[model samples]
Target: MRSLFTIGLIASWYASNIGVLLLNKFLLSNYGFKYPIFLTLCHMMACSLLSYIAIEWLKIAPMQRVKSRLQMMKISALGFIFCLSVVGGNISLRYLPVSFNQAVGATTPFFTAVFAVVMTSKREGWITYVTLVPVVAGVIIASGGEPLFHLFGFMMCIGATAARALKSVLQGLLLSSEGEKLNSMNLLMYMAPVAVMALFPAALYMERGVVGITIALARDDWKFLIYLLFNSALAYFVNLANFLVTKHTSPLTLQVLGNAKGAVAVVISILIFKNPVSITGMLGYSLTVAGVILYTEAKKRSM
Candidate 1:
């Protein structure tokens, strides 16, 4: 049962991430700038509600221990930071293509590996550094090499990478003390609510009144309400899955999987939205996959 739970948790996390990315791509095409804002809110809220039910009704606690107040506060703070990075990364998407955003997100593995070394004091072998070369090269190729240089969107991708890496590191930190209790469901309980709350100031500052939301939604400018509601639900579980994947697998494998997300998301975005991708972008995507494989191999050997 324990092993099955771990496998299920990992499968769900990857699938959930793919679903969230696809949803964001769909919502973005129909709705304009505000798509991410409300979507982010809905995502967190739905996830929180679901998580609460699972905890209370289904008894989905990951482990035995209940968290301390101080610990809860710490988790909340990390949630806030994670949500903020997500918002920033999503906002960047509005300016750039989804593939581009994802390519940038590939950088998360690089950031995670570095941070792991620094924070956890876990040192990778010298070969690990060499492995990153192809990953970086693949990302560059996947980003449409020259076009990325012309567009500022590349920077946004970088931001997404940083945000994701930081979130992963933060999650690991939260798990440090409460080792047994740090399962995916357990982490989601506190973090989801805090992340949802993190969106308020942005929503307030960029306030679109009830009428605007209605019109935007009704006009089919985007399934505004549906996007909001579903996203909130999806994001919570998506995050929960993340913890499970990281805990069950090697962090490097998680990074590789995370990097592949961009490759998969780009293809999905293009197929679903008819988003254009250059030859270089295709090459980059291929290279990224290669890079991930190479890195994974290096990691395996080091082990």
Candidate 2:
């Protein structure tokens, strides 16, 4: 049934995304890789290969037409933004606790909504706007009402969040365009390679020389490599699910579900790292999770 497919897709999407966060925590902590940009490059490379092969071999998209220069260029630019979303988040982990990182991420759905309106020139209802307030408030509470984790570092988190928001909006724009046909595989094929390339110079500069890059890769711990692979797979998994779910459900539902990742992420983070959970944190986490579920339920009823 259509409904069953939608349910399964959402479930798979959430699992993969939350899995990525858990693996990312491992990546940030264990990898000898020093540069955010460099680590991101490595991650993007892994995704690129997987996507390219899948798109070409599986022929995921219908043979509608090849994308035009203008559309391809737009996708490339969004690719760069996507790179920032990862690198910036990687950088943020250096300054903030993993739980804190996940907490701030709770605001993603609200920002997704705002970006949607701006990108599509569409109007959202009052209830939709009202729902965002609680999501955000929960995030603040979860963060212990902390101000920026570190001045520059916290700013980087904000940048990452903004990039994430933009990615969501841009995805809507790109996917909805009349002449553009992209399966999830096609989009990732275009993005991950280009994004990896875009990060090379930044990564190179940060490392200062080939020696730095060599040293980072030379350690080559098996455990760490496994984690990196996990990171790559998780990144692609949720993404493919995102596309498939979009086909079956509404974007608004996807956005709402996306917010719950923060809660799932926070719990796992606390389990892995023994993160301190304050009363405020408990309250915030509960509220954020409840709000996202409520919003999704309300949306389903309306439909």
Candidate 3:
């Protein structure tokens, strides 16, 4: 029964992750919402509200407090980074196909390793480092083959990937102590509101009339509100499912599932969006995923 519950959690993680991605793509690309920053802000808003309800009202996870000013500052820094990653990702989806986006995203492990070594002077084994070569090369090959390649989108996606990796590395360095280290759920509870605070001003500056536009759009079509609401809900579920899966299983398991989830998302996205994909693009994505798997194995062995 416990195993079954874990399976359900894993499934929920995949579903929520994929669902959020597809919905973001639909709203931005097909539905013509085009306001990536505002959309990301909405996601953070949902996360903030849902996390509060879950932790405070429902008592889903034991509430954890920020231990000190320094810890709160660290969490705030993480929130800023989270805003960068999520906003960049949403913007990239506006220009890039979901299939291609996942291909580029698969290079995250490469960035993570680089950031880890640079930020912490932590060195993985030579074999582990070698695994990153295919990861980088695959993205390059995919870029050359992608018919719908957009330079700005590619760059934004790369930025998002690097920001994500940096956040992971910094989390280890900044909150390594027992007193400072909060569990994922509580961490999200704190980070979500901080992210919202960071994103609000930027969204106002970058997307000046997005609020008015969103309201006008919703007035014209009530379904827009429904889609926005559902999309934001899915975003929160993605984070919740992620925390639950990590709690129930090892981080290694979560990493492996994440890799598989990307591939599954790619296939499902191609089907749903009917995005044209080349053989070279598929091959590159496969290679990247293969490299990530090898990297995971090598890291496991080293540990």
TM-scores for all candidates: the values are 0.80, 0.81, 0.98
| Per-residue lDDT of model 1, residues 177-244, tens digit only | 74434566666666777886777666756755733665656677455666655765677767667755
lDDT by residue for model 2 (196-226), tens: 8888888777767744554556576565557
User: Lowest lDDT 10-mer window, candidate 3?
Assistant: 178-187
Q: What's every prediction's RMSD, in angstroms?
A: 3.9, 3.6, 0.9
Rank all candidate structures by their TM-score, best first, as comma-separated numbers.
3, 2, 1
In order, candidate lDDTs are: 0.69, 0.72, 0.93
Give candidate 1 regions above 4 Å deviation.
Answer: 1-15, 33-35, 63-66, 144-152, 179-181, 207-223, 240-262
- Compose the digit string of candidate 3's lDDT tens values, residues 1-303: 999999999998999999999999999999999899889999999999999899999887899998789899999999899889999999999999999999888899999998888878999889999999999989999998898999999999999999999898889999999889888788888999999888888889988899999999999999999999999999999988998898899899999999999999999999999999999988888999999999999999998
The prediction achieving the highest lDDT against the true structure is: 3
Q: Give per-candidate clash totals.
A: 7, 0, 0
Clashing pairs in 1: 42-232, 43-231, 43-232, 44-232, 47-232, 141-284, 142-284
